[model samples]
Target: MSEGSVRFDSDALQQRILALRGERVMVDSDLAELYGVEARVLNQAVKRNAERFPVDFSFVLTKEEKQEVITKCDHLQRLKFSPHLPRVFTEHGAIMVASVLNSPRAVEMSVFVVRAFVRLRQVLVEHPDLAERLDELEARVARHDNTLSTLVATIRQMATAPTAPSRQIGFVVDPLEKKE
Candidate 1:
């Protein structure tokens, strides 16, 4: 095979990442595709180094969770009908897979993968005030929300409220015989 200069697209790798069960993760198939290996090979490596991959590092999806993922991620639809449940690896577990594989290519790919995860994290960390600002905005909106609601309710009540009966403006004159 001829080797040519190729650039790693961190953005593309980031797309494969997912949030599952409240943790950011990469599915086994996606990780294998990224590492240029068969998914089975990657799974084998993980099974061999199962100790390194604790529950936090990696976990198998339950049937219901698997269905939920299939519905959420278009790329994972293939696994929807497959009997075997898929495995998911957190940022740390993905790194462990590379060490377990012990291949030159896997090691090199791991560097890029780790960088991708770190890049995603850095992007989030850079905006530490984002959550704070959102909270402040919500509080401000909520603070005035009651006042606004009351004002609207008062206007609606005035509009719908009964009005006082009006008195006759002009002097009364008998219809049958009018006298000035």
Candidate 2:
């Protein structure tokens, strides 16, 4: 297929990619929509090319996880209502689907899927260091709070401390000016 035969919409594809089980994945239904095919057809292709997809490439969601996904993502309400659990395709798996389907639209849209995955990976890698830094800062701050509280108490005590008696400067000093 020619590059300009059809334009791929990366933005739309990006929205379909989701984070689950510490990896980004797209459900079969979303991929089918992107490739202009039905979900069953896509699943059939995956089944036919089973060797191409390993566990890392794709996995079926567990019942508990499926419930959590349904609870968290309103867009996946179809998954909630559907009797069968949905399978998710990771970045590599999504690209492999293109080769399996062997359609021009699938080939073109696969490029978009790959790009979306790349963008998602870049964002994940770039932003997580800050979260780690934030966690470290919070721990350090918690430790410092104990030290700070003690230091503040000591300062308050010093502020209210008693003054020592001073020696007379000279023999001519006024006795009346001094407290006995």
Candidate 3:
């Protein structure tokens, strides 16, 4: 293939990287597409060289996670009915896949993939304030959540609690009373 055909946009690659299980990962299908191979082919290669990919490097999504990805990612809607769960590769795992594939396209695209991950990390480092602000916002939300939960619990208790009997408002006469 010509160099022009192998061109990749870092932004496009970064978009494919997702946060799953507290780590940045690219779906196997996305990597396969980038590397010019079928998803199953890539997975088969990974399986053949399983030692190269540790748990931290790659993992298959659970049923609930697969459903969640399908629900959230419009592109992954195709995977909704797929019998096999999709595998996700971390930054290191992507490099490992490139080595395993040993294809010119895979090697070329792996550089772009690494850059995309680095660019994402740079973004966070460049704007520490954004992360700090997010943390503050999360703390505020947590406090509000606690307050709301307490309020709801109090309301529920009040609703379920027994109430005391009320005294009669009008004057009462004793039974069998003699008139003066």
Candidate 4:
């Protein structure tokens, strides 16, 4: 790439990093692009240090979740990994990733990502109504889930129960006929 193009890409990437602030967490591919490395390389590093990440620290997106993101984020759609599913990093995972990568951009981007996560949390703290809505939604979902479980159990029992025997003439098979 030419110097001008490089600068343009750098500026665009910087703006992206900034936009990612507050509530939006970057996926592995996005971070890799900003850090100038292949996405798989970053994923391999994370895989190597699996013990450092619990589910909350890093988790793969379900197919439906990935599709929802694709629908929401325009820039995310331009990513080469549109078809490649990604794993998300929590604030702590982002910091830990920077430490392992040992690159200047990784370090710099990690600072931004961590700050963004913090900013998002701060915003949520300031919005009690949003929190309340989230709580109500969660409780509603839980109730529905419980009801669904009971319904499923009842359906299963009904299906498994033996039906009444039909009152019809039937032939009796010899014991030897049951054998192969």
Candidate 5:
């Protein structure tokens, strides 16, 4: 994943991230990896330009939040090895940060991340009606509160009538389970 340079649009990335959650708060190390710089360097830049980053713009993770994030994101477990807690930055903070760092790569990559956030936000917004409807249906199902035959029939109707897509999502026990 770190062989050569690839072209990326920071604007698009920012947009995608915004769509995801109006914020592009990624761990410092992940940003460093994307920008092809050391995480220490990014921190240094932020420290040097402290005025540009406010509480909303950027801040170090709280100890409790850091632990929670680490647990949720398996890929970040290695962060435990570091002495310092990770930092998170909102979109505005990230954009300001790229300038402070003043590296072409950082600037370009920041735009890509920004666009990505925006795209995510857009997807969620676009589905508001569908999301609301699904929530209502779920609430109704919960109110019924029983795995009745009528409920099963309704669920089955929602499921494939056997002619729809054969493949469906489901959970399975460990495939290698030993037979009792």
Candidate 6:
């Protein structure tokens, strides 16, 4: 297939990526759709090449995780009634899926998938302040005793914290000194 034949939106692909189990991953259905194949077909291919997919590369979602995903992502609501738990694929696993499918569409779309993952990584690296803030927020949330008011106060205090004034490089005369 020609490059133009398979069109994948990077933004849409990015939206499909979710932070699950502390790793950024795309659900099997999402990947299957992107690869121009059915979810069942995609899973079958992976099963055939089971050795390629290690725990880190891909993992099946637990019941709790499935429920959480369905609640969080409106698009994944279809899986809510399905008996089988959905599998999630990290960046490496996504690429592997493309290879296993061995189709032109999958190969072409994999490039876009990899780019989306890289773009997310670039975003985190470029805006470290955002990551730091998220970490701080997580820590605050972890503290069971901390109320919302206390968290707000802590943030406000940090925002209003004073910084040291810069010293003048060279000044010969004091304002109070007489000129004569």
Best by TM-score: 6
Off by over 4 Å in 6: 1-7, 138-180
lDDT of each: 0.84, 0.84, 0.90, 0.69, 0.71, 0.92
The number of the candidate with the highest lDDT is 6
**RMSD of candidates 1 onward, in order:** 9.3, 13.1, 4.4, 10.6, 16.9, 16.7
Tens-digit per-residue lDDT, 40-132, candidate 6:
999999999999999999999999999989998999999999999999999999999999999988998888889899999999999989978
Candidate 5's residue-wise lDDT over 86-107, tens digit each?
8888777778878888888877
lDDT value, residue 43 of candidate 3: 98
* Candidate ranking (TM-score, best to worst): 6, 3, 2, 1, 5, 4
Scored against the true structure, residue 114 in model 2 reaches a CA lDDT of: 81
Off by over 4 Å in 2: 1-9, 130-180
Q: For residue 123, what is the lDDT in candidate 5?
A: 66
TM-score of 2: 0.66
- 67-127: candidate 1 lDDT, tens digit per residue: 8789988988999778899999998988898888877777777788888889888976999
lDDT of 3 at 180: 93
Summarize candidate 4's per-residue lDDT along 14-125 as a digit string, tens digits: 3343222123455777777655678899999999989987776677776776776666667778543666677877667778888778887777766666655676667768
Pairs that collide, model 4: none
TM-score of 1: 0.66
Query: Per-residue CA lDDT of candidate 3, range 53-117, in tens?
Result: 99999999999888878887888888987899999999999999999999988998888888889
Clashing pairs in 3: none
What TM-score, over all chains together, does every model reach? 0.66, 0.66, 0.72, 0.56, 0.60, 0.74
